[model samples]
Target: MYIVRFLRCLVLLLVGLATVTHARAADEDLERVAITRALTDYIDGSAHARPEQLRRAFHPDARLLLSRPGTAYWPVSVDEYVGWFSGAKAGQPTGRIGNVLSIDVEADTATVKAEILVPSQGARFIDLFLLRKLDAQWKIVAKTATREPSRRSADRVLFVLSSAKFHGASRLPAGVSFGEVVEAWDAFRAAGLTVDFVSPEGNAAPINVTEAGEFRSRFYDADLMYALEHTHAPSQIDPARYRAVYFVGGSNAIYGVPENSRLQDIARHVYERNGGVVSAVCHGTAGLVNLKLSDGSYLIGGKRVSGYPEEFERQDAAYFKEFPFLIRKTVESRGGTFLTSARDQGYVVVDGRLVTGQNYLSAKQVAQAVVAILRKPADQQPKQAAEKG
Candidate 1:
């Protein structure tokens, strides 16, 4: 009886040892994938100027600690830091350089070091990240960075504001949303990207007074408004001179932009011939509704796209009933698959050289997507457009 009992105890001890060994091996595998995912998220986010990607890479409480010339450590929450990229500067190239230099992992914590270079500004940055595993997901919990800034050549972006006024059916006074244009303009300027304004008729586009935010309201000065009104005509500019064409949105854009043949020509030449990006937000996508390549096929055919949804238009059905067509339905019918986020939240879709923002809220992200594409080497652009024809 004693021999039988001893044998049973030995068997139990062996099983317990094997279970612990297997658990440790499983944990090690999970940690490997988790570390790789976290690092990939950081690289792709930084390269593409995508805050949505950055948001996923970071923990909710992550903080960025920076050292500026005369300041002690300046700490910014991940939420606050991501806000910068969602602005006009959002698409501006960060000129990220280098791969993950190294990664060190111990238990549930890990660290990564990466480098970025802004050749245009002659700046270099080294970023260090501290991440933790929580609930089997790895997320960046802290970051520190050092930058050496220099000078470089600047690229230009054309801001194409809609020149129309009033919603189609009700003829209610409407123009470009104040927040859309001003916010995008501020972002572009901050990113050091040169900007110029254009319109269908080369005249100042009107403003939708009701759409202005506090920052835009305070910054709306006569000089700025006057400049917006005196925009350059499509015929007057060389597409080769610009890196991207951004279509700003307003209710009137749906009516005025789509029918402009010259604007279409400019967008085509820039995107097809010069390897530039074409972008639009909100009602501005109306401009793309009828855009075609040199081959006469629709530009957006087979593309993944997003814009203000058809549901939003129906919400104002009484007012929009007179429009020629809704933006979402039009794009979808033309072979573009439409994507939407929570109504009115910021969302931008990038498919090769084409970028579209869902609404006014998505304007900055659309611009950022454009900037990210432009920052890539010319050869890196998806040859989809070239092959589509």
Candidate 2:
């Protein structure tokens, strides 16, 4: 009887510990959200010349520290900083764009790093901020910034992911390849390019991670996960702001994405109208099979495309049976010349503005190719196969 009572007590204690752990995790998530909100307010407020938002983001006593040509130190109060933008009309273009690069939080204190770009001036500024959670609100308490010459464009890249979490009408799990997403993301970021995520259904994109390694461990952070969980819907994206659109692949890539008309339009706009690259890897190539240009010609028509062909799939597998269409066959039927390399080999085809990769191994290469093209002068960019009418 003593042993039974002791076991019961132990179980209760374990459950209580688990409950406490969960509560702490929940609190951390809330804190992260609050911190992000505060940072966004600062970024948007300054960019859009909104004084109220700037006031809300920073504490009244906050100071902006700077350095001048001959001065060792320069300091400006929050009021003085806000007044600098007071004369500018709200919601008008200031030729300034800001993005939060990183955030670190400890207890009630946090540090944030952000980048501000002034395209017109060809300048970039790095802003480091100290924030504190006070009275249930996060506020920037101090800010220090440095400016440098920059030539990088303000354009971003959009990563297209599917919303499918399972094989059609079956219990077999399916999701976007986490490996492909991370590989391409790393390459783009390394090239000083910003990336955004979008999905057909607009919310959290389901992810499939088969193995753990350096890239996985490195990118599996709260920021990336949160972006994936809150991906923009097709309607929210402005294709003009992106230099490229890359479709990520996995079993989930076979569904929802290929036939989504809105996604198709966004890709078309990016490619035909905005003169941006349209790329895909592995099963992600399915997204390109149905994309049509403004002239009503298939985007991949007569183009050399690479993807995971049907010959590589286990035709007998349950997952393969659920595929709405075979990637290689569909591409061929759409007037594309389907190409591939040996199983698991990295292979990419750059046909004009269309870029496609054979497998996950080629994901980074595809992104690099897109970045190369984007880095070129406008006159040097590959001519579109079908220009918008």
Candidate 3:
């Protein structure tokens, strides 16, 4: 009986300790939330706050930084920044222009990083701070930042499709084939990437069932017929804002994308202005043959590239003659470096910011490569890291 009573007491004590520990955890979480809110409030307050208010976001020893592509790094002490802001406040005219990225905490030391979107000035930045407990208050200690003028996800990425009929250049003689629009849709959607499809004449892009079923089966396949019936221009796509332009080709793309001046313009702008990824497979790459950048340089000039290899022309013997020129010759003539795999094989090329898949077998490879580029935050992927040997 005495032993049983002792065990009961021990159980009660353990339960009480557990309760205390949980309560303390809850309190710390609440504190972290409070800190995040305070920092957000501090930054958003920069929208219109005087120099003194912005200082709250930074510690006395903090520094403000700015970087340019080829110039030396510039760093300013907190006092210098505040003093400069006082003089420039009139011209700078602050507004709501910032984002909270991540807040990581370990014991008493914590790290918070932020991204702020600014215009006129470079808002493309990632700022990291070290926080330490001083008198039970968390204050930022060390700081670093980076900036890129034209960066981030495409202001938009749009997809163009053609009717499924005569897909794979079947209407033409052998060896010439193109991408399938339905597979393109499925690949993009599976990766959580946003996609929009439109037709050349503004009609619904068709889906070829036999070809689509070959890859994705019913579950992964898109209802190309149904999508065409309801397709709309993507609101997320703005030529100036897009960081990448993707062309989804089908055998029908040979007849469609080649003359899409609108898509061509979007592709050229996104590439030149943003250094974005412009990708097409099979016949879709044909659309790029005529595009010229601001310098009047062919967009693909001197860059490694890939598309449906001419070998596929054998696949449909008669189709090869219809194309104005072979895909390989057109790209190579413009001084663009061209790449391919053995006939009907998967080939993907990564040249600077551009990624291209050789043919239908290479769609997912192209999609993953583009995402790798998109998901790479500028700060983490320092410009130097991308430099090839």
Relative to the true structure, how large is the alpha-carbon lDDT of every model?
0.75, 0.86, 0.62
Poorest 10 consecutive residues by lDDT, candidate 1 = 380-389
Each candidate: RMSD to true structure?
A: 22.8, 5.3, 18.1
For model 1, the stretches where C-alpha displacement exceeds 4 angstroms are 1-152, 221-223, 314-317, 382-389
lDDT of 1: 0.75
TM-score of each: 0.58, 0.76, 0.51
State the lDDT of candidate 2 residue by residue for 1-389, as single tens digits. Answer: 99999999999999999999999877776787799899988888888888888778999999889777897589988988888667746666677888776667789999988889897898888999999999989999999999998775677999999999999889999998988988998789778777889998886798886542456774457667767776888997878888899999988998999999999988998987888999999889999999998899999888988899999999999998888899999999999988777886788888888988888888999999899888898788776432110
Candidate 1, residues 1-389: lDDT per residue as tens digits?
99999999999999999999889866765675678688777776776678888789999988889887798799888888788668776666676533454556789898877655566557767789999989879999999988866332246678777777766656667688767787676666556565677787775578777767675554546445655755777776778877888888877778777888988888888888887888888878888889999999898899977777768776645657657788888998999887777784788788889988888888777766677677788778655422110
**Which residue runs of candidate 2 sit more than 4 Å off their true CA positions?**
1-41, 48-75, 86-95, 100-114, 118-152, 212-214, 219-226, 383-389
Most TM-score-accurate candidate: 2
Error at 18, model 2, angstroms: 14
lDDT of 3 by residue, 141-217 (tens): 66677765633321345665544355344553221122345555556655444455555544344554445545445
Better of 1 and 2 by TM-score: 2
Ranking by lDDT: 2, 1, 3
Q: Superpose all Cα atoms of candidate 2 onto the true structure and report the RMSD in Å to 1 decimal.
A: 5.3
Ranked candidates (TM-score, high to low): 2, 1, 3
